[model samples]
Target: MSWPEGYGRLVLAQVDSTNAEAARRAPGLAGPEWILARAQSAARGRRGRAWAMPEGNFAATLVMRLDEPPEHRALRSFVAALALFDAVGALVGDDAGLALKWPNDVLLNGGKLAGILLESLGPHLAIGVGVNLIAAPGAGQVEPGALRPVSLLGETGVRVGPEAMLEALAGAYAAREAAFVTYGFGAIRTAWLARAMGIGAVATARTARDETTGTFETVDEAGHLVLKTAKGRVAIAAADVFF
Candidate 1:
């Protein structure tokens, strides 16, 4: 597969973490870059939770410098989610059971298939992605009440190696990124909600201090989770959503 143009690419046999590597290389990057690792010894997910990297899974980070506001930059999580959804669907040649969860997760057959994490590195942003292509942690490995993890191979019986997955993902991301930069988040948000799971359903958003239980309304233009509760409409800036 052809790599995306105007983007730097690197593949490592081993690394402490792709995101960490991105940070180390961000200062020297001339443009957006993708860092892929065969193995990561110190990987992490959102909220600094440990992220498991089984052999043959997909672990990569896209480091790019954007001159947008932090809020706009943060919306790239949705962009990444859409890219992952497209890439994986293309690989399996089907998207029947694929869906995107709020915040930063990609779901397959109602299970967590992949996750996206965004971190700031001075002027650059590191968008770390982890996909379960071959193996996934057991349900017990995740926090209680979290969605059970699933893998592409396990769910679809289609095996994809890290490099091949990166090619698809990078291209997909580049397309989505271009659209986002040109048309803004309006189109991206609309597209995301079309594939989003749990819209108009009752769900709960658990923040650090409180848990808000309400019907999943819609994701606002600012990328906040809008929920319709008995009290009124609430827009959650950040939270762990549960259905």
Candidate 2:
């Protein structure tokens, strides 16, 4: 199939981590933007954890070159999240029980519908996204409080085809990329916060060092989750928050 302007081509494989495959192919590719994968055998999420990807799930990775400085890299995650949110929302419904979690997670009715992983590949970056189209895998299952994972078909009673989802994602991503390049991360930041799952609610997060319980503040311009704890406001760069 002929890919859209921003998207070069969709490379589908039976199995392999899209992020890992994209990382390996990024150096030899001519352009900076291309998507690869059909399913992931060993998908990964934040904190170097594995993301379960069974058949019928949507697994893909987008490779792109950013002109922005290193400090602004987090904007890419916001953009990717916005794209997935918009695409999935359009397919299901505006109020399709969809919400964007901090960093890059797509939640449906308070459960995880999709998750994104962004990794640096030399001068380029690979943004990997996994969505539960039919069934969600039962690996790396976390606690059941706030940050629980859900699936698309499980929520909407509608089976979203992987190819269709990819098309929508590519289109949404292209539009968001153009806006990010032209207007900067301000626009994306505003939209992301608007679709955020919990803004002023209390949440709990665990990191490698310690655990934090605080109010969910707005995501800062740098894409860090700003939390208001008893001591003071702390900017969390990486941590899984339980809403």
Candidate 3:
């Protein structure tokens, strides 16, 4: 299949972290490339959480040189989530219980099936993507407070290999990125909210200081999650959400 313009591919038998590899190699690298690893020893998720990517699961990071502004860079996480949601839909079908959690998470059957981590170095951003394809982490394997982990294999009784997932993801990302460039985050936000997992539900968002409980409202124009509590609308930029 044809890849996105300017994209190349790389595979590693093993790597401590594909994102770290991308961060190191992107500066010297010429164009975008997808770096995938069979196993990750030091994988990580948002907020310094240790991400457990077992051997059979999928670990991939897209390395690309980006010269966009800081605000534009911030929007990439949402764009990435939408792209990944598309990829998941391809495997599980659009009618499946695949939904996107704001910022960077994909939910399958109301459980987390994938995560995204974005790291920037100069003009380059290493967008790391980890999906649970063959299996989700067994109990006592993952960090606390992760959305109950689920896997495509467990949900659909089918094992879609990592290579095929990557191919679909790359294509989906290219298409979504194009739409983002042309129409901006407004369009992306609309599509994301359509497949959003929790909009009317009550959820708690814990920040560094304290946690706030509210009705999960819509994500605002700037992409901040808008929560409606007794004290009007709370615009949350960063928090761990629990439903």
Candidate 4:
């Protein structure tokens, strides 16, 4: 019916985008609500890429208000990414191959397993998370070194559902949210880098403006993607990362 604590719950059969629903209903919401759906006809990933999510997979958005200003609240993406890591780890057992990508992507066995998208709503925020649980889309023609889409069922032969993921996600997020509030992003950054993929490795980042080739450096305290390019260490606040 509802989450144990922190977030309220609204499960839908289908919607355009959970984030869109969150934005529409965020004003009337009391505190926080996990807006989940079985299928999304218009799921959008980073860079507005069309996310092909079938009925078996999970697509949800968590709507909430952050008193902290937008700049600071943006750091919550790291927190949510880490929380989902913990949740997936709990389901499949933590493995060395599983890692977090820069910004907000979760990788499994070197493939893309999950992604988190944060959309700001003035003082509020919409944290959209998508997980490949039962079914995964084909790699379809991706660039070299690009991550292929993977699903838990394909990787572990285990079938997890949105209901189970929401429970574990809420619990995992509570702890990480507390750590973020108490200690700050510095603490979270350390843990994130520990499980980060492609750090210290040569990679390329494509932003809206330009693309830069460099070594994937560390993320800053403010959660910017740090890169070691010919121009020296550059902090990218927003970009699509690739290796």
Best candidate, lDDT: 1
lDDT of 2 by residue, 1-243 (tens): 234674576566765687787777777777755565666677788878778776788888888766557667767889999999988987776655788888788888888889898888778788888899888766357544535567888888878888888888888888888899899888999999989988999988778789888999888878889989999998888788877
Candidate 3: tens digits of C-alpha lDDT, residues 107-131: 9888889999988878998899999
> lDDT tens digits, residues 1-243, model 4?
224576798999989999999999999999888899988988988877778796689898989988877779888888998988988888877566689998889999999999899998877899999999998777773345668989988998878888888878888887898898899888999989999998889878887789888998799877888889887998888888888
Poorly placed runs, candidate 1 (over 4 Å): none
TM-score, candidate number 4: 0.94
The C-alpha stretches of model 3 lying farther than 4 A from their native spots are 143-145
Maximum-TM-score candidate = 1
Lowest lDDT 10-mer window, candidate 4? 137-146
At residue 158, candidate 3 shows an lDDT of 72
Considering TM-score, which of the candidate structures 1 and 4 is the better prediction for this target? 1
TM agreement with the true structure for every prediction: 0.99, 0.92, 0.95, 0.94
Ranking by lDDT: 1, 4, 3, 2
TM-score of 1: 0.99
* Predicted structure 3: lDDT: 0.86
Per-candidate local distance difference test: 0.95, 0.80, 0.86, 0.86
Rank ordering of all candidates by TM-score, starting from the highest: 1, 3, 4, 2
